[model samples]
Target: MLFTSSSSEKEILSIISKQLLLGSTDARHPFRFVNLCTLDGNQPDSRYVVLREFKEDLALFFYTDSRSEKVAQINKNPNAALLFYHPIERCQVKIGGKAQIITNTELIKEHWNNVQTEAKKGYQSVLAPKTAVSQPEEGWVQELKYQSKNFSIIKVRAKQIECLQLDDEGHLRIGFNKKQEVWQSTWLVP
Candidate 1:
């Protein structure tokens, strides 16, 4: 287990922050892909999103097409949840936050420039995501470009974070909440 009963809340938070930061840069990290849940009307919509960046202020960013359904959902309801789990470590982290579409032109350009050439096709598709097409290839662009207007970033500012670590002895859980720019943590029953 990464944490134990004797672990302090600060230590656990540090570990989680470190892991998340590492996940942002390491493609193979378990936290690299997260389950992002957003409200679609009264129902919950969940999908896997790559962890493109993690800020020290508890903000996480991911790339998506501007015309994707998720962008529409976030526009209607900004509240969202993110789930990260490592099967081998038997640890899970759940984050509740508010999501916003990043509109800063420079920020979007920076991220778009970093996207690999081969992966750029996803954003350069001729048709918007989820568009109906008779053939699968019809949805894709016939000619690839270095960039597309559909490239966008979604930022999630975490309000509450809960971590659970499974151990043979017993499970350990902790909760962290941010208010007024300060963070408060507490041990939770598991």
Candidate 2:
């Protein structure tokens, strides 16, 4: 593929949109999982999270337990990062942004409604996440009701996006940052 400055920018955006859309349909898709990074004091914490939703040119959505340490970290410091890699395509994307927890909102409720009962059971645990347990089964109770309070969604408002595409012919890198409420993109050496 030819990589002119203009064409590369367009191709980068196209790839991002395509991969995000693919995540919604293909469970095995590379974009289905993202490495989410949060700060715990001066230390960095990272975990693999499912990519739940992608809003074009806006933000990414993921769900987590409100009692989880990541949620608490986000509440304390909203700054976060997400990294996604499509090995088959040899494309990688890194996003830096601010994260906000959504709970008790219509959006959260709607997300919960869409989840299956079996998955919803995850939020119904009586004990908080990361709690010590003598046995694995003792961690969760056979609850009669789902704990809506524990179900939380995260919205990561992207401020910058860095994408790299590696191909047999050549490699391309592009960076996009929000400036004056508009996205300004530039080509980076890969």
Candidate 3:
């Protein structure tokens, strides 16, 4: 079956808000994703990260070190892509946007202050992501604390979004593009 559904970028954006506010029933927020792509230094890089937060028509947040390569890559290339999926629901969401490193000290504190010790453990890694080094080992973290000062948040102001509905009947694609501060979506053959 070719399932067809479309919405204004803002409306579909609302769909995400509905999901995020629906308590733990929403698995989209926790899925590990591999979609932030960077073109820097002659080579493109990407990585998997937890989906942190989103504001309508504005920015999406994910945490990383100010010193990480991804951070540096974003500096070189602000364009990036985001992929979201649910195994049981069989739904996928794509977000394409220009990224800006969050620089507001207050915003950093607000986001960091909410980070629990467990979540903060991620920032304590000794090995920088995508770095090649000696034998890989774990448990070198000195401590687990909500230290947000050293971390930088990546904010993507989405310019386009492509939602793919994957099921038995091949797949269905929904495309949304942002123009003049408005979102437009169309059905495309998948």
Question: What overall lDDT goes with each candidate model?
Answer: 0.91, 0.84, 0.68
RMSD of each: 1.1, 2.1, 3.7
Residue 12 lDDT in candidate 2 = 63
**How many backbone clashes can be found in candidate 3?**
0
Off by over 4 Å in 3: 1-13, 20-34, 125-146, 167-170
lDDT value for candidate 3? Answer: 0.68
TM-score for each predicted model, relative to the true structure:
0.96, 0.91, 0.78
- Candidate ranking under TM-score, highest first, comes to 1, 2, 3
lDDT tens readout by residue for model 3, 15-34: 65454333123334434453
lDDT agreement of model 2 with the native: 0.84
Per-residue lDDT, model 2, residue 156, is 95
Model 1 Cα lDDT, one tens digit per residue, 1-190: 6678888888888888998998899999999999999999999999999999999998999999999999999999999999999887899999999999999999998888899988887788778889899988788653465565889999999999999999888888899999898989988898
Which 10 consecutive positions of candidate 2 have the poorest summed lDDT? 1-10
Model 3 TM-score is 0.78
Candidate 1 residue runs with Cα over 4 Å from true position: none
Q: Which candidate is the best by TM-score?
A: 1
Model 2 regions lying over 4 Å from their true place: 1-6
